[model samples]
Target: MDLADDALRDRARRAGIAPDWTDVTGQARSVAPETLERLLALIGADEPAASVPPLVTGMVRQAIPLPSEAGTGAAVLVLESGERAEITVHPGDDGRCWVPPIDRPGYHRLQLHDREITLAVAPPRCFSLDEVARGGRMWGLAAQIYGLRRPGDGGIGDSRGIAELARAAGRAGADALALSPTHALFTAEPERFGPYSPSSRLFLNPLQADPAALFGQGRVAAAIRTAGVAEAMRRCEAAVLIDWPEAAQAKLALFRALFDGFDAAAEAGGGLAEDFAGFVRAGGALLQDHARFEALQAARLAADPADRDWRRWPAALRDPAGATVAAFAAAQDREIRFHLFLQWLADRAFAAAQAEARSAGLRIGLIADLAVGMDATGSHAWSRPSDVLGGASIGSPPDAFNADGQNWTLAAISPRAMVETGFAPFLDTLRATLRHAGGIRIDHVMGLARLWLVPDGMAPTEGAYLTYPAEDLLRLVALESHRHRA
Candidate 1:
């Protein structure tokens, strides 16, 4: 190979793009040079400079090594509890300066010179199943969220059904109820109903939100009747196979009617309205991004049915923070608020379900299943495109289950972006899953270490495995799991 070719391979290797991989058939194959180049460009791989990283992670009570340059700087350790300590970075036996062990397992800030870095101190391991069940063995059941049924679910399973199941399962002595992915999906394209291919892992499927839980059942029934979905909902419940597009439409119409009532209530001022305001406040920018994306996608689809994908929208609208998007949001303020209401209802319903399970004497309550990746055209990619691989899809090589191979058409998180952003995207996704659950079952858990990435529009056989910062990710997961006691 030429020197330039050699350098390219070196850069690819440093970026964690595997030069070769073994297939499911136990055959070794090498990634093509062009394939490597494409993957590398998608990630925009740039090695971090010689400095303290955006974030540092280590176990509690374990001394952490600091960069040699950090030795000369004044280090101030700010604990999460508002306490502060001035510490010295002394060299260890290996001749590297190490910060003193932190006693707490929490995210603390370390100020060194002009740079402030986050210290993510994790527990040694995750909360074990033994701690959850407190017995020799534990048993639980798993269900698809959409397949769950309850009276007047609007032709699809809703969080109210989950609450009902949780109560029944707890009464039956089940310790946990595992759920399928509840991640948000495309509101404009209801036919795309795969739960695993979500719009954003940081948000819930608003379609599954059951307003009946918040609004009294009587009020919800009135809304459903007024929305004229009562007949369709009954048919959906009786159908052998779900009519996703129809059911989703019915559910959304019902939600809109409920949202109208909610807005009216909010204007009058009450505790529930304040609670919703608090939810919106806590949601911060992330929540606004998701809600805005939902509203914008719907608006785009209205103008042209084929314009649902944000990437194909006007360039100005493609950027979440662009002027066009801001103007669109301003013009459609009520539409955006309607989407926000959906999320608010979903959040409250899920939280209530978990609470009911726990109150019914189930120890673990719920184990939320987290999807492996997000849809390429979804909210996460639209709001923070750099945080994910743009021109790649997550998939697997030829395996026993599928001889032709499989292309999930899902976006993988960009490893470089994770480091540059201090793993904020990863942490947000994890925290979202753990928000109202006792535990989380990470789909394709192997993706934590590495993922098989297929170039967009390329055959899965042409894909290569991309390595991740597994150690750091696992540490974060353990820390979160311990915090949630899951």
Candidate 2:
């Protein structure tokens, strides 16, 4: 049979699935009887060897539903000659592949039939935040936050305001303050309006830096607070309206004032020691590359954002792995230190708030929202192109709220990649998000089963439904939730 022949062409045609087999078996595009036999046994489709999918081997998303009470997330399977990912049980929703960290980059998988295949299992490990079922007396103030604006904040509250709001909410009934994601937004023109959908989850928005708090002394903050205390209060009252840029500018002022403190801390730690060590340990060469990329970005701010690729920058800064790249990396070392300091501070403050909420006899202080994926142009996509959805975007088919359905341009982790990579990054993301929350609200929970992926260059409506190992993915989530009590 022709590998590109559409066996189910009649039905698949309606769903936008074509017989094209261009990307699957790249160079060594030939089927081997041996590997095919192994795969047939794995999927329990060995009835007639002829029935197995021909070694068209491109990107495979093999999802095998593990034996269980069916519909539960649980499974066991090896990749194209890799470690076995087994989920003994399953969880409720999100029975698909686990999510990964935003900073992690690249696709790590073994090639099969000269193609990329994301292996999947039916009995996939999965779970929800409430499944762990642990609770503490904690209450956090959840609010929408923003940064600078062209109209000078234009009534949108900034990070300085957010910190103060956290302080106020803590003083009130809340033990902590959980604001919208403060991930870095695009610095160029036509700023994106959505906060949940961000430009970069790997980095914080500089708009929220609170420059005045950092740069100005007690005098400057006091000046803003005292001069227009009522105005600031009114601004907070009009929450939900976020102006990213202006808020970023105000926060930068505060950040600049307080930067000395960060400097002092780094100095004490001995020359950006902790952050550098942490990045090396966590992200490996990719992390190093990302940090270096950021440094290069800062130096070449003069260029347009679209043309900011280091390769196209100054002659001295062309190659990402060359001398210019090294110099840029060195310059960014300081910024990296500052970024680490900020994250540490944020974590401690949030954790403390959770603790205080617990003390106050509250239940469910911090409920983190886990997005389905990341932004295409953001840090996460840049790092791991393999794990991320390249020619597709995850979205809804047709829902009541959106008759046309919604096309969330956020990037996604390919199911096939997860099974092959042992779901390492995907599993890590779940572990991280749940760690800080009393509970989590997984957006688009249905993503566990099937994702409507709009093929590259196609309109959202032209995508097809791709299924995953719902049971196995969920079971893994349950396993992790149970293990960590998250």
Candidate 3:
């Protein structure tokens, strides 16, 4: 390579793009110059003026060096618990000063003279299995949530089935019950059924909700009879292979019946209705956005099947913050509430399963599985486009098993956006996965360090390894693991 090419590769390397890598076959691969340039532009790797990043992360009692400009400023450390610690920036002989050591592990703040940056203090490591099992090795069972069987599940698995499995496993001396991803999938097109390619990792798949978990079995029985799907449910249970579309339709119909008279029950007050209200209140805008997207997608699909992807929708409706979306949400108020009700039921159902597991003598109870990516046309992409790579697909490079490489067609979290947005998106996703679980299993955990990203219309083999803020993300995971004890 010439000097110019070497210089270009150096720039790419400094920007966290791997200009060269070693494949599984022990062969060295150099990224094409044109490809590196394109990826650099796509990732916005142009160097910015020296400044504090949105987040700084380190282990508890580990002193972290700040940006050059921030090293000499007067700083105050603010703990997450509303307490303030007066600390000074201690400059070293090398000129860079270190933030005072934080003894606590949490999302604290460092108030400097010019800027305030979030200090994510993480424990030394994640919660250890030894702590949960009390120094003994413990075993657990893994399950696919959809394939589980129980009476009255409308032909597919539901949270009630999972609860039963947990109880059984706990009795058998299992310490954990790991399960497949419960991430939300498309309710508009039930045929697109895959756990990994989800609509939103922030929410649960409502189809797996067990109404009887929250409402009584009597209410569920009445709703099933009222929806007139009793015979259909029986046939679904009798099927050899799961008919995902039919099962989803049946489950939606049952949920619809329960939602029909929900207003009356909510008005009656002091029961599931009050609990649902509390849920909606706690859910806030994020929940509202998901519900609105669900309702809007279903409506558009009903009008014209071609209107599947939100990107193709009208310019006004394409923007979640636009007036058109507000108008649509206002018009479809009840429809939006129906989606919210589904989420509430799903959340309650999963909570019940975890409760049953822990009560049945399991040390860890349930360990949730977090998918690496979401569908590009899904709710998360529609609502928060900036949080993900806009036109790229996350995939794997060529290896012994796949010579041509593999494109997963899943959207990836944008590394640049994570730093620019203070890692809010990643933190939200991590917390959501750990919400009701004793632990979490991250699919493709290697993605935290780097990912193979194929730009739209590009061959998978043409993709390059895009580096991520591995240390910062790991520290965030450790912080959340301690927070949730997961």
Candidate 4:
């Protein structure tokens, strides 16, 4: 190779960008220089010639490297349990430090010289299955939550339907009911419907909520008639496949009417008013952001049917915490409250399903599916833009299945950002999925180690593999798993 090629390859190697890779056919292939440059740009590795070693940020069972300033001195180690200890940092070659065994498993802090670093001490393995199985074979029933059919469902299967299914499964000696992702989808753009491609993994899909569960059958029926969607509902229910647009439209109209009645009842001091108030209070900022996004998207769509993506909206309204967004929330207060109310009902319904399964003697009641990532233009990315990588798409490399490879068009979380944010986004997602379920099935679980990322407008085969902080992510998962007993 020429000098220029050698320099480029060396730079790629330093940035963790593989210059060449072995294909599935056992043939060695070199990555094109153009591909490398584009991929490097997406990751913000502009100074490719800079030789920098990976920084050690956390510690588990293995020892981590330390800076030169961290001399051979006793460092103050603070455990997650508020216990502090002075541990001697033994210096080694290449500016590395040996961290002694931390008996506890938690996020701890280490003080060395003038620097303080967060050290995560994780257990060797996750919660063992034997603990819950007790040497017995457990059986589970996995079903598509949306495909479930039931009377008075108004076309779309919902949490109430899942609850009935759970009861039936429990009676049949099933220990678990695994359901597809219930992640929140785009409320404004119902045409872009796919359970796997959700707007946010941190919230539930309001469409899966049973209006009748909270509003009562009579009230739901009255709302259906009031909204002039009874005929549309009948057509949707009788259809074989889910006509998402039609069903979503009908449901939204009914929900608006139901919300009107609910608001009036709550105004008269109904008991549910206080319950909903507490739910909103508990949801806090995260819930408020989601509700605002929904309302804003709807308002934008109404103004111009072509404007659906938030990225295309006015600049000031794009930021979730900006002054414009806050003002919009205030102006569209009623609309935002309607979205929040739907989420409240959905949460209540899913919680009821899990309760039903457990009360029926099932050890593992509900197993919820957690999609790998969310659409880049969706709420999760908009709300936590820093945590997500821009100008890249999650995809798969060329293989026997598809010679050209496949791009899922999903935005993945940035590994570096996750570390910087102390994995708050990941932790929040895990906690939410575990809230109303006994276990969570992580979609594309292999993404924990590495993700195949393709630069925008590029062929999937030209994509590069991006490494993730696998050990750290797994440790967090295990921690949450133990906390939820999943």
Error of 2 at 412 (Å): 0.9
Looking at model 3, report the run of 10 residues with the lowest lDDT sum.
43-52
TM-score of candidate 4 on Cα atoms, chains taken together: 0.89
**Candidate 4 lDDT score at position 203:** 94
By descending lDDT, how would the candidates be arranged?
A: 3, 1, 4, 2
Models sorted by TM-score, best on top: 3, 1, 4, 2
Model 3 residue 191 CA deviation (Å) reads 1.0
Compared with the true structure, model 3 gives a TM-score of 0.96
Local accuracy of candidate 1 as per-residue lDDT tens digits, 191-251: 9989999999999987787776788889889999889988988888888888999989888
Locate the minimum summed-lDDT window of 10 residues in model 4.
48-57
Better of 2 and 4 by TM-score: 4
Task: List candidate 3 segments past 4 Å from native.
Answer: 1-8, 47-50
CA lDDT, candidate 2, residue 437: 52
lDDT of each: 0.87, 0.48, 0.88, 0.82
lDDT of 3 by residue, 112-216 (tens): 886888888999899879878787889999999878977799778988898899889988999899999988898888988899999999999999888888888
Q: Can you give the TM-score per candidate against the true fold?
A: 0.96, 0.59, 0.96, 0.89
| Cα error of candidate 1 at position 223, Å | 0.8
Name the lDDT of candidate 3. 0.88
